[model samples]
Target: MFGRPQLVFLLLLLVAGLAWLRLPGDEQRVRTALIMGTLVEIRLAGDPQQFNPAIDAAFAEMSRVEKLFSSQLAESDVSQLSFSTEPFQVTEESAALLQRGRQIARQSDGAFDMSLGALKQLWGVETENPQVPSAEQLQQALAGVGPEALQIEGRTVSKSNPHLQIDLGGIAKGYAVDRALEILRRAGVTSAAVNAGGDIGLLGSREDGKPWRIGIQHPRKQDELLTTLILTDRAVVTSGDYERFFEKDGVRYHHIFDPRSGYPARDCQSVTVVAADVASADALATAAFVLGPQQGLQLLEQLPQVEGLLVAADGTLHRTSGLAALEP
Candidate 1:
């Protein structure tokens, strides 16, 4: 679901002496809450006084979106729809997300089903006592996960099955980043990056007008980089098993579940997707992980705007031809 070690390293790097080492004119620094169903770091750089207000407004807007999409909050629109029998109406932003979810579900052959909320609860991935769900529970969840069960009409969300639940965990954060970036750009912030966990959306370039250099971490090695790429106004998102998991007997169960089996898909070690936007990258990364390394590469080739980097379970690296040219 995320690159845990990479994310931790980035957090540590931010606070460990790196904050004081700034370029000649790149002295601006502002901190804001990054919305990902929880508050995380959203650091901005530029002229502190002027940039501070824009950063604050962007984060405030993101927070408002978080409340709309979060499933953890019992009062959220997503949560209310999970239990409601009637068609749940949503705002334009939410409706757009639902439409994107359905499009990915269709394109990924149900590999990226948004209707996995019930399955997620059964596994308790966010709970303190995470364990394997019972057979009965898995069966009930499986019954509710088919993409056909979901229906989106204008601004209303409905399901053919009342028990069907939708979870936007795979796409929400990236969507939020895109929304935030739009706000930042509108505020005249040209050089910026919005990193929602490992999903990053870059704008223009770094302060020196150079493309932002980002590394793709090696799945098997903690401190190694599989490859690095230069990005400008693009989004990078990784879907992997390393983020959260627990072992049952000898088998390791991760948070990313396959809707078909109500269990984690096990073919690829990780899938990193780079796209024109964060939401697309986020959705495609999850889909690529489910598609496995070979098919995932094929899928990326077919997509005109999406490129992918896949790490197989056997420690092999796979990417599109264009990506090979960009890889370092």
Candidate 2:
């Protein structure tokens, strides 16, 4: 699982403060709540009668997923599994997600990992005193972590080595976004957008029958815009070195890490991926960031319904050939 910030949004508006341009009328409804430690905003268009109920269901789903998968929570499903000595039985949904995490882990060759609990602790990225761990500590952190440490057989999951510490933060938020949109769709929503921090998923189109507009935030200059994308019925996720980092001796150590090395990935300053679902996009964003620009672009090009934009550590820009068509 990955931890990421929210994306900017809607018609070039900055969503940092949740300051979406509000539409006053019965046609559109917007709601915001703090879920998964991020300001999640849901905008719905179409039937007014279904707005509140759909938003309610979507929020409920996100909260449920967070409670089940959050690594920080002592009682979360995954957290319990992390500390369990014996095989743990989980819900069908958790099983599916764990399996999906494994698939993505293998696909990215451990770049997008679900087992980074110890690594996260070693880095202390979320704490006040985040320091660079020693080589021994980093090696210790990598013990039994990655796709191999995790085992999922239907509803049962077990750790191959007890030293494994699993964290689903990489996949949870995006999976929540996907599930939320799925709920909205099931409720017969004609058009809707779910923006969790910046990992976003869309359904149908905007109220004006135009494609939804999303902004890719500039990594170094957080306040500035990178580029705007015109999209609909898709999801986009961005992972960057600029988010959640502390500078030490002129080097910025960010939260996103390479599971293999137990260190922050340095290949790209930022990587944005667009895919049919937020889960895939989120996984790809982190993978691309770790794989570097060249290999990352190759990975994206090999996949259908996926496009990526990468800002290399050397200040070079690389992107899929088709990404230009989505911009103005």
Candidate 3:
């Protein structure tokens, strides 16, 4: 067998060839890594010359926003703000994101607390082998998670204790998608969609004035779409244990955690939110997962502009009462 380094080299060569093949001739299709996140695709639909520098500039702006919000980077503004003993200083943009985070935490009744970072570290969701933490470890982490622990004054955020770490990975991707749409709109791109790791935000109608059709991944079936959403200038965000999980002795542990117990929520398989903006959709996806199917639907009914689709642990799909109206 070939050595591990040789195997990696072969994989890189294969991926590069595939990427080159995917690009169309005459129109420069650029797929570049942005914000230490996923690969972003910038495709020119019409004549290549019609594309302006503003389009590329928008991508750069998105990368800057990602760095500001990412907790994975030890030097990120969010990391410092979350751990700051004094009031954390923030720019106008970062302040707006933190304000939105607080609004969602209040609306979700602590279900979507941003202070659940310590508990996330204990579970190691992105790690290769995720585990169930000991009850003692969980208890200590849970002590630092709650909306009451966060104090947001305008753009400044201060935690009551040093143990609290803020992880916006759950919502930042969607928020970034929305910010990208704003940039695209300002650049005179009428019809566009930003898919940041499947957190989608739709701009204006398609070139032909038709709404964009989005496929919702089936929770149990790999090749099937549960439903198709016809969106026009809306944002859709989904969170699910089905995407990533560790199965131990037939029990699966996923990333969506319950702040109360610091454990992977034993509730829904997936939750999808469609809203006017990405920030609300992002927060609602996590909140609904923690609330489970029934209470999650109930919560959606209370919000006029938000609709939800929930897949239960047993694979049954439940949608908010208002979902029918938004169906294409």
* lDDT of candidate model 1 versus the reference: 0.81
With candidate 3 superimposed using the best TM-score fit, by how many Å does residue 184's alpha carbon deviate from the native?
0.6
Q: 1 or 3: which has the higher lDDT?
A: 1
Model 2 over residues 72-161: C-alpha lDDT tens digits?
Answer: 899988888989988999899999988988887887878888888888888888789999999999888888776677888889998988
Better of 2 and 3 by TM-score: 2
Candidate 1 at residue 175, lDDT?
86
Residues 1-328, candidate 1: write the lDDT tens digits. Answer: 3379898877887875565664543435535464664444444556667777877777877787788889978888888888899898878778889898888778888888888888888898778888798888899887857666678889988877788777889888888888888888998998888777788888888877888888887777789887898888899998888877888899989988877777888988889999999988998899889888888788877888788899888878888878876665
Model 1 lDDT at residue 35:
69
Which sections of candidate 2 miss by over 4 Å?
Answer: 1-28, 47-49
Provide the RMSD of all predictions against the true structure, rounded to 1 decimal. 9.5, 10.2, 9.5
> On residues 77-155, what C-alpha lDDT tens digit does candidate 3 reach at each position?
8888766767777777877876788777877777887888888888887787577889998888877577777776776
TM-score per candidate, in order? 0.89, 0.89, 0.86
Top-down lDDT ranking = 2, 1, 3
What CA RMSD would candidate 2 show? 10.2
